[model samples]
Target: MPPLAIMPVLRFDPAAVAECISPLPPLEHTTLYENHNCSTSSTKVLYQIATHHYDNGVFEMKWGRVIIICAIVLSIQIASADTLNLTAGTYETFADNRTVQITANLTDSTGYPVNGTRVNFTTDLGNLSASYNYTNASGIATVNISSWDIGNATITAEAPTATNATVNMTFVVGPVSKIVLTSILEGTVNTTHLITATVYDKTAWEFANDENKWRIMPDVKLNFTITPPPGSTYNSANITPPSNTTNKSGITTAIVRLDKCAGTNGINVNVTNEDGVDVHESKTIIGVAGAPVNLSITANPYNVSANGIDTSQITGKVTDVFLNPIISTGSVRFNTSGNIITKPLDGTGEAAISIGPSIFTVNVTVNGTYLDEVGNSTNLTNETVVVFYTEEPARIVVTADATRISTTDIPGVNESAITAAVIDRWGHVLSNRSVNFSTTLGDLSSTTAITDANGQATTTLHSDITGDATVTASTLNDSGYEINGTIVIRIMNESFVSVITNIEPDPVEPGGIINVTTVISGQGNITGTRLAAHAMLALDRSGSMDPDYYAGTPLDVVLVLDRSGSMKFLGSGPEQPMTDAKTAAKVFMDNLVSNAQVGVVSFSSSSRIDTGLTLLHSSDNKTLVRGAIDGIYASGSTAIGDGLADANSMLVNGRGDARKITVLLTDGVCNAGSDRDCSNAIAIANANHITIYTIGLGSAEYIDEPLLQRIASETGGTYYNAPSSSELRAVYN
Candidate 1:
């Protein structure tokens, strides 16, 4: 068999041939020619058979014919192998049952388009418009696909004529169903936090082993909205894309800013798709306090007495550089040069402490910390310090330069000099303190004198009456205690002349000078001079006079009281200046002489006649005056001049037969009304022949000493400076 050339015969199944050729055009009969050669040893002859088909039967086959037919069939199978290429118009769509177009291009292996080819289409998810499609004259086939369920879908196209001509595309189909947020759960105030929101679609489906299911959607346009918690805010610039829009992946990111006092803050994120499907997610963030940067300390009363028993309050406040108060439940420690006591801070970041009554200035220092709930402590960077001073006063002494004197029956003769020295308990002389001088049976040159640098105060006393006169010197110590000293002096009337009178011609004409002569007999000595007197008393009831500064006295007098607002400060315990003045006036009325008349006038910014001048001899009149005084209350401003004018009016209109006098007492300056000038008041007293006695109570700073002195001097009266209530009682006596 190897020696001889063997010919291979091509065989074909009739059913297969029929099926493959059914769509082809029918072949016509063709005759084959033979070629012959006659020469030499052999003659060769070749004959080509004609291919044909009869209506009824048998067919003839030739080797050359079989070869030609086989070649044609093989070429057609190769061209159909790569004729179709599939592509999707869009890879993503919503699961709302919307349709998408899928296309397949028909082409041969040489890249030449093959028309009239049948293409088959299908999807792993959803449905297609048709399972098969024929390529058009342009060699392209298209189908519409849709999905009712959410998921990813795979679309495939294949040419039925060619086994290797196939193409597939994946598409996403769904609506937004869920959202997720990712961020830090806690952060400091005024800080930034990275937040991310991921959008998902519950209707989206994924395919595995020909099965379809829901999955995350891709290539979807998502919109995001962020809602910050209370006391928190967001940064517009920190949002990606600036419009809070998600890309095809359905994700958005932003940075949020929290407030300074943020407590437990939560952030909410909402996401929606183009189809109007939405979802939400939330996250909680814890806010922390800032660091402390400064501390301030203060003392309410920076100074106290060195009696070693007083205390002061020390407070400290903690804050940041911005001066915002630090809210914490922490304690602060206090240090001092003397003694230290501690207290915790309140909600306002303030702490109070008690200090000691020491001799030296106390330097206080404060240092502390603020703690947060997370056990973080912030120390104060600045140190706070405060100082307190302690002061005290000790004792006083008095002396007299001359103790005795003698004078004739005159007004201003017998004079004695008195001196007072203020000495501290340590034997050191203290100056600038006031010493008041009073006499029981005489008049003093000056009622008040301040101690000089030498710690000495001097005054002169004079009396025309021959008797024993008592002089008192008093001052108030630093502790509000009274220090007093007194001395008695004998006044003897040593006049050398007795009563002897002569009249020129026993009588004289009007406006003519008459010669009068008096002779001294040296027989009788005059001891005292007596005169009837009428007096008015003016009193101040300013707020500072709220203390019980006076008691009642027995005298035929008009009580004028100041009822200014400052009188509220006048009194001790339950007795105010007005109340005390009323008590004193009532007592004076009780002790008045039977034939004496009493009245009452109370002045503030104005004056009123509470009780008119009435003889105390009548019990009914006394009751009426006392009741009026008791009804007086304190209000308004101090009107010294107005008060004096009113008192002068009462006395000038009263019983004319009585010698007139006025007493004025005030604890404050005249501060109300045009009459505060006081000159008019003095002139009125002088015109009425009323002797004015002025009493200044309290410190020199409060009383107008020069004005009081002028009023008393012009009226030929005395001025008394009562530095304290006890001294005032002595003045009344």
Candidate 2:
């Protein structure tokens, strides 16, 4: 017989089943042990317990047919684990008691629908309409969420029996937060600008479809309008999608064309949302003026000196065709014949420039570009400013190659070259100037000459007469002032005169008239006649001449000096009659011929021969005379007679063959000596045939002029009256 067949008995409860199934641990088999207790009459019951193994961790019971039915029921109650996907139908809503719908879909791992499962909905920001819900046959559960506060909220759908398996959704609730407009606000006049306005919902979400295309909310519309500034117009003809309706993404765009206008302008963009509630936003765009169309320049103090400090102001202004000032800051370029200066224009549109020193007169022209506001520049504009310079003559200098010239025997052979130099105040040469040349006693080669690069003008002077001639150079300055320079040239005749001497009856007897004659002759065709002769030099030597008077050559002569006490006070300083007499006597000696004889006599109350008549052929004789002259001093009374007598005695005793002459000089009348009267002395000189030259020194009251004149006349000699030491030298000469 076949083994006894048995079925397993299993029981299941649907209410006790978990929402999710957990994974089973690895196992080989399961075992069960049973203890049976039965009481029966006439028949014994037998029982067997067994272990079962299955691949799915389910135990197979072999008991009865009811176990199969129980197994099927338990399998149906233990549902498979599933995932829940939560989605927000609308991501945003108004916070004013508005609600957002959240939907949750439950599915198995393979994406099959899981039905009859309880799903719990929760939020971090708002309250859900239903905290718990069962998924429908389609495995979808939906709930409504609401919040009083304006903020973002997270919605979660979860299965209680599934570990960490949940679905999340994001939602926002509030009024319109902000609006953004995108565009380049700046554009040239008469140009168009593409402006876009993007509207953000209460959740700052771009409401769009899955294709990134905007989805308009129910009954929501946007109004795009642009308001231009005064004196400016806007054109909307280029705007696409003619209506001002927002696309699916709550974004709208418009093309705004600006009218021609200068200076700053504003374009306002305003957007209004008409979706059951009034929501609005605005944006501003700035417009700028066009490029410069016209430029003008002006200058102040057009004329300036060449000095480095002189400056001029050059101003320039830039504007558009509408004549509106550009408000931007820019630089103006300035150019001139001299230095170039560049400076930025101030708010008033002006610049200042200057130049350095100039050597000569010059006319400067200035040119430059005018820059307008906003860094726009116009074409070059130029203006001329006159800078005049005046030159003045600082000085005029005249020079002559030769100071002296001979008479023009041969036209231009005997001449002098005269040069005149004209210079500026700073000593710089002034060229191309006219200088006039004129002469007093000579003829010039040219009357006028122009200065060369070296500032010099020259002319030749021809001597006309035998005298000094003056050459004058004159020039005119810038101020019409005349400047002059002069030089002198001396002219002399070529001919000169000489003397021819003749002596008749040689060795004439004493006391006899000797015949001597001097013939005047011209060496070369002389034009004038003149004669001169030597004379006896009578000088007053007193204490007055000792104070180092003017120098003179020593001559060969006899000096009759007065040594009286009155002579000391007769003249000034060392120029008293006695001292001056000695100086004058020395001058006379220096003028004498070398072979001539000289003697010295000093008289006071008495007379003494300081030096005897001696030939001046040797230097020793001159030294002896000088020594004797220095020895005479003032100490005694005046004795004019003794002085004259002693002079005559010395002359008469000398060589007879030589010309005998006596110099009688005295400053006072006879006051001492027995022969106080000079008549005896004069008579003795006449007897010896001696020529006497008389000089009366001192004032008229001191010396006896009548006596001296008589003595000179009686001896055939001339008488000289020397009132001063200077006249004494002249008389001696």
Q: Pick by TM-score: which candidate is best? A: 1
Which number leads on lDDT?
Answer: 2
Query: 358-425 in candidate 1: lDDT tens per residue?
Result: 33333545443443334355565334454544233354455544455665454333566777777654
Which ten residues in a row are the worst by lDDT in model 1? Answer: 71-80
Candidate 1: C-alpha lDDT: 0.59
lDDT of 2 by residue, 1-733 (tens): 2233433222234332221112222223332212212122222223231223221323333432111111122342223456777787677666544667788888875788767678887788877898988888898878888765557777767874344334343443334434566887566655677877666554444333332432233223455555555654442223333346556666677776655553244434444543445565555555454565655666556565444344445555655565544444555655554223345555554444433234334465667676544436567465645463434786788886656556777332266778898877644456789999998897899999999866889998876577888889999998898998898877666654445344443223222344565545453354443444432222211112221222223223457788888877766755566667778887888677555778888888877666677665433345456545765778688787777777787777777666777777777787898677678987887898778898988688878888888888988888998887556777888
Residue 314, candidate 1: C-alpha displacement in angstroms: 4.3
lDDT of each: 0.59, 0.61
Quote each prediction's TM-score: 0.30, 0.26
lDDT of 2: 0.61
